[model samples]
Target: MTDTSEMDRRAELSEFLRNRRARLKPEQAGIQPFGGRRRVPGLRREELAYLAGMSVDYYIRLEQGKVRNVSEPILEALTRALSLSEDERAYLRNLVKPSHRRPVSRPKVLPGLLRLLDMAEGVPAYVVGHRADVLAWNGLASAVFTDFAALSPRDRNWARMIFLNRSVQAVFADWTSKGRDTVAYLRVQAASHPGDAELAALVGELSVKSDHFRTWWAAHHVRDHARGRKRFIHPLVGEMTLDFECLRPADGGDQTLVVYTAEAGAASERALRLLANWGADAATGAEAGEPEVGRL
Candidate 1:
């Protein structure tokens, strides 16, 4: 690699560390405040270094982008000190030791995958790509959430909807937490695909348009969007709580199949059935060339 490129990488690593450190409060790290008022928002450099079992000078050098040879043990200590999540730790490792492979093109949702999604009769399922673009979704997913077919291809993005669409905002029971987690998950993707123009543009747009996104992006929180419980405020069926799982193919493309399901005997399950039936009716009406009903 060129010296200039190396310097750029180091600069990014420095900025990431500084941002992570700034988000953590002194008390959160179990540090007692001294006599003077803190000019900085989070723990001081010395305190962080102490907690990481490193010298202040060494930590400063690391933060200054002067040290390139970081050991695993030191990285582990820093991870613990900053209270980094599993995804954050992996991102840190990537920053320190970036992959040499060429940038990957966006993965396409295969026909087989679409068939599988269609087979999920009562479940709401969608495939999300690297930039959280809703590549493909089942009719039940459209019924449960906003209809992706109605939106333009460029707007078929989870991050975009979470921030820009009022309908999406209304659907989430806890919009604040959902927004934060979405941004954090995007951060993880950004780290992995640093050269993706679409991802960069999306982040820039969201940062400019939404204060909530800007604040969460600056916090440097990272999370794996694997499994979680989500509460949705559906206009047709009222409120429903569902468990979601993210599945990846063995071939290892930058795509995940996300499925949301409610407990078998729960009210949420009944609501889901109602939603599926509604979707089927809508499809039938569309096939019969009936006027489309406006989204609720």
Candidate 2:
């Protein structure tokens, strides 16, 4: 089964090229008024190839999965011709980087570290790792995110929440792009830590269970999710666009601390205050791993 590595590579090459082609259009590239009966949105194979100053045959071969190895110069030409976004361009380069997919190992979080999640005051905070495991979160985070506390340790997958959770699906205003980024980020994580068995299992589950994840993963996209504006439609709080920052400790390349905050005086701020009050008033039950007030 794994012997189909070459096929996989070729399929990725074919798929990305097709997607890029489908995304571009004839009129945008300044083609004259010969626009009747066009079957696609973006530039066609030969047309795009011609615009990139490459032979139509060569581009056709790439698109048809006939070309195995592509040079950097030609790749750059294709990148520009396709008008790739920063993320798309980076993903393109990563796919060509000769390496196998690996999983990042999950780290052991000391109790103190997990407790830090609860110290963010008004801001929502949570800790995740390379595999998108929910390492830890404070009450505000639990309030901001869907019932994260309810998920089994093994079932806590950010990607899964994005797709499976109806609440999470409604969270991102631009759900499609957010969904794509989640998949792409997983691809990058899978690549960097191929040895992580847990990550492998996660990918396996997603690839088999979700056709949408399967489609995106096969495209071989990669992304570095450092910071961004996240729109969350919390069940308790209507819609909140929060500025999120990912903090990686000096000793922590794999572990990421994601904190969320709203612009001062925004409706999101009011929603978060309401969430915090709900969280404070809501009895905090002791989880399996964490220490308790009486026990130790």
Q: How close is each model in CA RMSD to the real structure?
A: 5.0, 5.1
lDDT of 1 by residue, 1-296 (tens): 45544665677788889888888898899987644888888878888998999999999999887777689999999999999888889888877776554444445576566566657667888878878888877677888888777777678789999999999889999999899989988877777765666787899899999999998887777787799999999999999999999888777667788899999899999999998877774321121122234312
Model 2 clash count equals: 7
Q: What would the per-residue lDDT of candidate 2 be over residues 1-296, giving only the tens digit for each residue? A: 43444555456667777887787776777665244677776787778877789998888887877765678888789888888767667556645554554433445654554565545678877778778877766667766766666777666678888767767677677787887888988876654553556776788888888888888877656677789897877767788989988877776356777889999999999999998887764322223464222110
- Could you tell me every candidate's TM-score relative to the true structure? 0.84, 0.71
- Which regions of candidate 1 are displaced past 4 Å? 1-12, 23-38, 100-106, 110-112, 281-296
RMSD of 1: 5.0
Pairs that clash in candidate 1: none
Report model 2's TM-score to 2 decimal places: 0.71
Q: Please, what is the whole-model Cα lDDT of each candidate in the order they appear?
A: 0.80, 0.71
Worst 10 residues of 1 by lDDT: 282-291
Range of the 10 consecutive residues with the lowest summed lDDT in candidate 2: 287-296
